[model samples]
Target: MAVVEIYDTTLRDGSQGEGISFSAEDKVKIALKLDKMGFHYVEGGWPGSNPKDMAFFQRIKNHRLSHARIAAFGSTRKPGVPVQEDGNIQCILAAGVSVATIFGKSWDLHVTRALGTTLEENLAMIEESVGYLKSRGLTVIYDAEHFFDGFKANAEYALATLKAAVRGGADRLVLCDTNGGSLPEEIAAIIRRVRDDVPVVLGIHCHNDGELAVANTLAAVRAGATHVQGTINGYGERCGNANLCSVIPNLTLKYGHETIPRSSLAQLTDLSRYVSELANLHPNPHQPFVGSSAFAHKGGVHVSAILKDPRTYEHIDPALVGNRRRVLVSELSGLSNLFYKLKELNFNLDASREETRRFLEEIKELEHQGYMFEGAEGSFELLLRRAYDNYREPFKLESLRVIIELKENSPVYSEAIIKLTVGDQVVHTAAEGNGPVNALDNALRKALEVFYPDIRRMQLTDYKVRVLDEKDGTGAVVRVLIETGDGERSWGTVGVSTNIIEASWQALVDSIAYGLLKNNGR
Candidate 1:
């Protein structure tokens, strides 16, 4: 089997993205996870840039990594500075990481404009910095920054810079598409030219400005590149880096290369979602392999075909990437789609000709009235069960009141009182929270806890609000979607009302009801 090394720069380049920053603890945790996932190299940030990165080097020393060798990133020696006297070079050596990667100018334009130095001087900087790092016994990876653009503009100078690094004993030469504007064919052509001319192991680092980073990377691998650099969820500056979530699965399943252990491939979905949460960024549902909607079938015809044979609609088995096939029900859903989804909920309703029409009509009517069943499966299941069988209510709401007050010098306070009846007992509870919706959620949970203790375990994970008509301004009817989790799985519920608080409260009630129903029934 061919060995294509996976180099993760999420902790370094990924953090360079706008609205993205990781704490020292976040970096350590992510580094450990990458090591667990068996990446060949994990690049921590430049230690000299910030205290957080410096602290990461000290903090990571406490635990031993299993697979990944941590690498420290830095730039080449300055124009007038000696390798030994340069602050950046000294910091790279001081970093406790096992490997060192230094980026140098490969583009003559950047060399002239950014560095304001002669082309020959840049070559000397690359050679001295790489040689000094290699002399320190650190595995050196020389990143030929903007190699693709430089190769297009002046192929001779770019090749000269790489030759300088090789003369300095750099182990690997990484060609970077820093501008991310190179097409796959252009990348393949340039890399092939470099391979025929240069005699070093090649790697590729791409940006997605052209939306072709993944394609260009695959082209690089196909053109004899042995190492690939990317981030977990493709998180990086500008348009982001090549997505490893897509790259790993494509390599293992499509190209038949074992970049990581085959068994570890199943953890890809979890790893992508985990990093997104830590970064406090909402996961992209449409991302290739690990996204929520990657394997989800929504069209009525597609859902029906998938129900008969998933291969009819799917390209590859979703289970191979730790993703499941989902059939979503909506106005576009046919009767088969509804039946298929009901089966997932463990409900076997008799879908006779007449009954199917009745259920479909009701679903279509609800969808026409601002209800979306695509994300709210719990609500769909409850509605499905009710249509087929005698549905039982776990609790009944009697009354509710919410109060909000703005203090002169203090923060606003929101309070709620809820009265509910469970079996023969009526429970009343009052609670205070940061907002009116939160207060209602607190009071409802408190009242329900007396009857169903498991309600305490359910938490609202996400809340999305959408206004139906912006022309109405404050009087606009808003829809609230609340996602609830029980430490294991998640379900969504939705409500619509002119008052945002009322809509939130309705969704909150449905969330608790669905949670209690599922737990008690189980």
Candidate 2:
């Protein structure tokens, strides 16, 4: 089987995404991860664009990589300057990489209007720039910018541009759909034409404006391209670039093309989450293959059949992508669903079927009262433990009070006082924080540290709020969910109240209780 090479640009093009930025250290860490993951090429950044990118290239000199070659990206030499004299060329050389990728204009309109250079001069620039790089003993990959749109407008000019790169000693010619609006069939047809005409290796670089970047890139590959360029998680300018997370699985699993090692397929979900957290971004729930909701079942009938045989509802085993099937416990759950959840909590169900039915009914009533189990698995586990009489109280909440002081000309200040009992000893603590929720969390953790020093190892990682009954106006019920994690494990708990502080406090208390219980194996 022929293997297509994957070139990841998450640290380069991905950083171009709006509201996204990665420091040089962050770029180096992600680059190291990609290298270990077996990407064929990793584009670190454009050396001249920013100080951070320049620092990245300088810092990577001391490291060793297993599988990936670092590629420095830049444009072709300026319209008239000698290739050796161009600042972009100098930066590319300073990057100290074995391979360099340079993009040149393929459209006549761009050459004439944007570049203010004749089409023939632009062609000469392409040839001279690539020839100069090759003359320096560096492998060059030429990017033919706007190839698809240019081909539609003037097929001769676009093909000429690619031919110039090939004639000038480029090892590969990457045809780029820079604007990212071309369809799969259009990409396939153009790639086929180029493959027949240009003898050099063909590659693809696609953006995601039309949401067809992955489709178009795969189509180009089917038409004989061997190299694929994309950013991890689809982070890039505008609508973003093709997502390697989506492309890698599609190629290896669906199309039987070898890119990443077959055994590494199972690490997809963890890899996705790792990158998202490192970037301080949330993962998209609808993302293919590795999303949290990728295999979630909620409808009663759907869950019923899935419980019998998951293949009835699922397209593939989620474990293949490092994700697991999740049966959502909601107001719609039946007795079978309750039993399934109980089994997960290691609770033995009684032989009385009526009791199970009563449990399901009560779950629905609680859900209607603003309890949400989907995001509060820890709370659900506690409920199951209580139902089976197997739960032990880790600590007792003696009292919790929030005091707020408001002045006419001063900012309001809130302090939380928490009193707790652990093993016949009572501890009291008070703290001030930005809000009632933060203050309460601090006070509780402070008081608990005396008894459970291990509490310092955990933290509240995420918090979310939902309005359960908007029709009730100020009297509407609200649900709060808190996600906590130690270095190894993560759990979530939920609480509901009309008062926001109360809801937050309830979830916060459950978070600590669940952590203690799990730590002690209670």
Candidate 3:
């Protein structure tokens, strides 16, 4: 089997994703991460298009890379411009990189409509641009823009365009699915035909518009493509690019191909979540393989069976990808969920099966009252530990009072008066904020600061309130979910009650306790 070189375009293509923007410093951080992961190539960005990317190349030169080569991306010289006079081509050379990748029009329609150039002229541009870079001692990777679509519209023209790149000494012809509409079978067929005719090394670059980018990439690999291009977390314009998070494992485990070394495979989940954090996007819970819930089992039957045999419900061992199995206790669960969760928490609940039955009924009743535990494992853990004889209380809330005052020309203000007992100490504090929730958070933290000053680092990253029954006209039960982060890691805690304020308090208290407990090793 041939080795497939992994090329990442995360810094450039991934920034094109909606709400995804990285500073020059952010690009450097991500570049170091990619290089450390042992990728073959990391395409930094288009130097000619933006100053941030241009700075990345200049700044990245000082650090020595161990594994990956940095590639600069650009388009071929403009339709009628000389390669020497093209500003974009000059930028690529100025970046001082070993590898240079340039995209050129492959589709006849793009040549006639988008570029307003003749087919023969486009071919000349591809040859001239590629030859110019290769002549300058740069390893040129020619991205055949829209190669698959071009093959469908005019197969002869597409093949001719690739042939032009080869004549110009392009090292690799990366077939691009720009419109991202092609399926896997179609991709495989096209790649096979291209290999039969085109003598150069072939590569694959696909978008996820059809939700088949990974599938198409794998299909191309099976058909003999030697290079694959993708972005981490599938971040890019539109539906995003091929997700290396999914493709890398699939190639390594399922296809017996290696992108990164077997040891680096464990870093896949952390890498995925790291990128998600830098992008400031929540990790998709349902994302395959690396998602938080990827190995989570909720149904009692599923969890019970997994304790017997993980392969009964799981396709691959979650630990293989640095993820762990999660048993979620919900209204849909049974005693097995509690047993699994309690054991993980190291709680020896010496209860008979009848007592376990009573506990299950209690959980069902609370869930019916809108207490959701799945997203609030911290709160659930506290509840579980409370059932044991050795469990110790962290702090006890004595009282809380919140006041909302509306002004004539300003926004409403809220103040919270709180009292708490930490061991034998009774503390009282008051704090004001812009909203009721913020005020409550401030008051609680102020009271706890004397005892646990590290609690000051807890930041409420997310808060969500769901109305369980909205028809009750201000008397409905609500569920409040809060996400807290302690500079390094984060967790979710939840509370439900008829009063939104009360529910918010429950989650806020749990968020603080969980942060202290986990970080301080309580």
Candidate 4:
């Protein structure tokens, strides 16, 4: 079996994605993670582009990478300038990398129209650029920009451009589907033809315009390519580049290719989340291998079978990708599903009776009012604890009230007052905020803090509101989900009501109360 090389460009091409920007610190962290994950090459960034890339190179210069070589990406030299004098080429050298990648126009239209250069000059551009990088004692990889479409337009000319790079002593020739419109069969055919003509090793770099970047890359590998280049989370221009989170495992497990170690595959899901959080990008729920909903089952039958044996519903054991199976609870849940959920919460269900049925009915009633327990396992656990007599209310809600006053010449303000009794003491507090929900949350925390001062350390990290019945407008039922973090652990709580403010207040109150209860071991 041939050894497959994984080239990760998450910090470079991935950063090209709109609204995606990574700090130098973030790039270094991600680079370290990818290196530990055993990627063969990590394209740090385009050193010639901006200060961030330059800073990234400077910061990571001294760190010891265990498995991956850090490659600096840039374009070929200008039409008239020598490669030695080109600023882009100089920056690549100054970046102090062992390997450098340069992209040159391969399409005839791009050469004659976009670049305003003749065909022969473009070929010279490729040759001279590669030759200059090699002379600088850097391993050069030539990226044949628009290679697929260029081949379709002018086969001989595109092949000639690649030959120029090979003759100029490029270490590897990377075929790029720049526009990402080529089919899998086209990629395979092109890879075969290119491999036959080039003496140097071949690699693939695919975009995701047609949503087939991963497919085309795999197809190319099957045909002959040895290196697969992609961004970690498919972050790139337009739709994005091929996702390495999906490709690496596919090639290693499905195709039996040797890339990352099998034992390290389990880190895929967590690594994906870690990178997403660092980038401040939300993880795509449907993304293969590492998405939150990748192996989640919500339907009754699906959950039942998954409970018996996960393979019955899962395509791959989620544990293999550092993720666990999640059985979702919703209107689609059945008795068996509810029983399984209760069991997971450490509840022993009465299988011979209708206990699960009663539980399902209660869930349905709560859901009808706007509550969604699926995402608030902490709240659900509390409910189960109460049902099984294992729960104790840490504090009591004596009273909660909202007061709103509006004057014709002034902005409206809302104030919430809460009176709560814990043990023998009663605490009251009033707070003002922009909205009724915010006011209530502030006052509630203020009241709680008199007794449980630790509540002050907890904060609402995220808030999501869903209207259960959209047609009803303001009268529509609303579900509020609140995520809370105390600088150590995070948990979610949910509440539902016809009024959005009420729903938010309920969730916020439950979140804080649950935190106190859990901390106090009640």
Candidate 5:
């Protein structure tokens, strides 16, 4: 299989996305991660553009990478300026990276309107900038910015820019869809045309403005481009860059081309979510290959088929990408959904049993009352174990009361007094919190900590509320969902009631109970 070089730009172009900001340390950490994953190149950042990038290049030198070469990104020398004198060009040299990626204008419009330079001067800039980097013992990757649009506008001029880079001894000529508006067919056809004229190794860089960056890149590769450039999770400016999470798997699994090592494929999901964590952005659950919902089955018919053969509903075995298959149970589920869910929870109930049928109906009835178990698997597991395995509650709630007070010039005060029982002993506790839910949670924990010290490791990560009936206004039944994590793993539980406090208390109790159960290895 032909190998495609994987060039990641998460530290540079990815940070251009709104809401994404990677510090120098963060960039170094991500670079090390990519190296360990066997990416060919990691574009650190534009050293000329920011101090953080310069610091990243300096700090990354202390750590030796195994596979990926760090690449510094910048533009070509300014028009009419000496290549050695241009500050941006000099910064790439000063960054101490073995690879330098420099982009130059291929569009005549950008030359006249953006750079206000003559066409010949732009070509000179491209040639001189690449030559200087190469002379400094750097592997030069020349990015032909806006190559596709420029080729459509003037094919001869775009080809000329590539030829200039060739004259400067560029190691690779990367054709860029800078505006990200090209179709797959357009990319394939243009690469065919360019292949006949330019003699350097061809590469591809695409944006997702048309929602086809991945498609366009695949098209380019099939049409003869060897190098691939993208960002993790498609983080970039505007619509974002091509997502390597989707790209690499498509290349290796679909096209029989090699990218990162096949054994490292299982790390794809973790890497995607890890980058999203540092960016402080939520991972897209629907993203292909590596998302939580990519291999999830919910419908009755689908779950039935998946139990027999997962390929019936899933495109690929989710385990190949380190994601697990999830069968969701809800009002729309059939007996198959319940059976599959039970099997996952280590229960093997007969699907045809009368009690099993009754339990399925009960779950449907609960869902109709606004208790959604799909996002509350912790609650669902408890319900299942109780129904089939004769499970006992660890603690029984006796009563609870919440108080909220506000004064003229002071912060609002909230307190909760809770009473519960463990075995034959009754426990009473009082605690203060920021709100009614927090107060209830604190008091509950205070009451139960002595019996189950493991509860201290559990922390509430998310709480969500939804009004089930809007027409009733204040009298509407509300649903509360709470997500709790204990460092290593997380679970979600849900509750529904007309009284907000009651709903919150139910969810809070389930969250803690589920954590305890997991800790006990039950």
Candidate 6:
């Protein structure tokens, strides 16, 4: 199998994105994860730019990496400065890594306007900076920033910049789509021309401003580039960088390139989410391969076809990327969706049964009334069980009351009182909370915990309320969705009502009931 190198810059380039900030410890953690997954290179950060990056270098030295070579990233020597005396160049050498990646101006516009230097001096900076790092026993990767744009404007000057890096003994020549405006064909054509002039190994780096970074990178690879640069979730400045989460699968599964170990490919989804968590960003559910909704089927026709063979609606087996196929039940769902879900839950409800047909109709009616089960699988399961002949109620609600009080110079007070029967026992409880719904949740859980102690393990993670009709004004019906988790697993439940408190109570009760059902091994 032919191999292509995978270089990750999430700790460096990705952190430049808005709302993304990683501590030195976070960088170390991500680097180790990349190493474990067999990435060829991990760019630590610019040591000369910040103390956090310097701290990263000092901390990473304590642990030995298995697969990835940690590369220190920096720019070329400043114009009119000696490479050896340059502060950025000195930091690259002091990073103690075997690999160093330095970028220099390739476009003439940037040469004069961005760098404020003569074209000849820019070439000398690229050569001397790469040469200095090479002489220091570092494998130098020279990035020709804005190479695609430069080639389009002045092809000869761009090729000249690459040749300069060659003369400097640079190990790899990376052409960057820094502006990310180049098309795939443009990338392919430029790389083909550059390959004829530059005799070094080639790599491709791309931004996502044009939303074609991954496409442009693939074009460069087909045009003879052997290395690919990107971040895990495409996190970067401006729009973002090329997402390696998409690139890796496209390379290995679609193009047949050997990149990461095929066995380790299953870790891709987990790795993407782990990085997003550390970055304090919500995972994009619609993102290509690693997203939660990547393989989810919703339409009745699609679900019916998917039941026979997943390939009917899916491009590839989701498990190949550490994800699974999901059959979502909604107003658009058919009997097939219910069947698939029931099979997953170890139920044998016949599709032709009258009760099954009525159950499906009931779900449709609920959805028509603003109760969407697409994101509320926990509530769907409870409804399905209720239709079975052997089903039994876990607990019964008798009455509930909530109170709110306001006093001058004092914070508003909210409390809830609940009465419920568990088997033959009646338990009543009262609790105070930040709000009426929270107090209701607290009081109900407090009442149920005596009978089901495992309920203590469950906690509400998210609560979202959507108004069904904005034109209905203050009397509009609302839908409440609650996400609950039991440390290891999480599920969503939903309720719809004209009263917000009543809607919240229904979803909250279903959440606890479903949690108890799972804990009881039912």
TM per model? 0.96, 0.96, 0.98, 0.94, 0.97, 0.95
- Candidate 4 yields a Cα-based lDDT of 0.87
lDDT of each: 0.89, 0.87, 0.91, 0.87, 0.94, 0.93
RMSD of 2: 1.8
C-alpha-based local distance difference test score of model 3: 0.91
In the range 83-160, model 6's lDDT, one tens digit per residue, is 889999999888898999999998999999988999999999999999888888999999999998998899899999
What's model 2's lDDT at 2? 66
Q: For candidate 1, lDDT tens digit of each residue in 1-522?
A: 478999999999999888898999999999999899889999988987888888898899898999999899999999989889999999988887769999999999999999999999999999999999998899999999999999999999999999999999999999999999999999999999999987889999999999999999999998989899999899999999999999888887899988988888888998998899889898898999899899988888998788888889888988888888888888888877877866777776665568777888888888787788888877877787677657777888899899999979989999999888889999988999999998998898888786788987899999999998899999998989999999877899988788898889878878988898788763
Native-to-model Cα distance after best TM-score fit, residue 118 in candidate 3, in Å = 0.5
Top-lDDT candidate index:
5
Best by TM-score: 3
- Taking the tens digit of each residue's C-alpha lDDT, what string does model 4 give over 1-522? 578889999999998899898999999999999889888999999999999998999999879999989999999998988888899999999999999999999899999999998999999989999998998899998899999999999999999999999888999999999999999999999899988988889999999999999999999999999989998888899999989999988898788999877888999987898888787886787888898778878898998787788889887888888877777777788776777777776666684467667777887788666678877877877777777756667678888889998999998899998888878888888999887887988888877777788898899888899888889898888888998988776788998888877788778878987898777765
Clashing pairs in 6: none
lDDT of 2 by residue, 1-522 (tens): 569999988898998998788888888888888888888999999996777998999888779999999999898888888888999988998888888999999988899999998898899899988998899888999999999999999999999999999888999899999999999999999999989898999999999999999999889889999999998888899999998888988888888899988777888888788778777897877788888888887777887788789899898899988988887778987665676676666666762478777777777898888898887888877877776666767788888899888889988798999888888888888999877888898898888887888799889999999888789988888999999998877888999999998999889888988888888875
Q: Give the true-structure RMSD of model 6.
A: 1.8
- Give the lDDT of residue 66 in candidate 3: 92
State model 2's lDDT.
Answer: 0.87
Worst 10 residues of 1 by lDDT: 344-353
Candidate 1 collision pairs: none
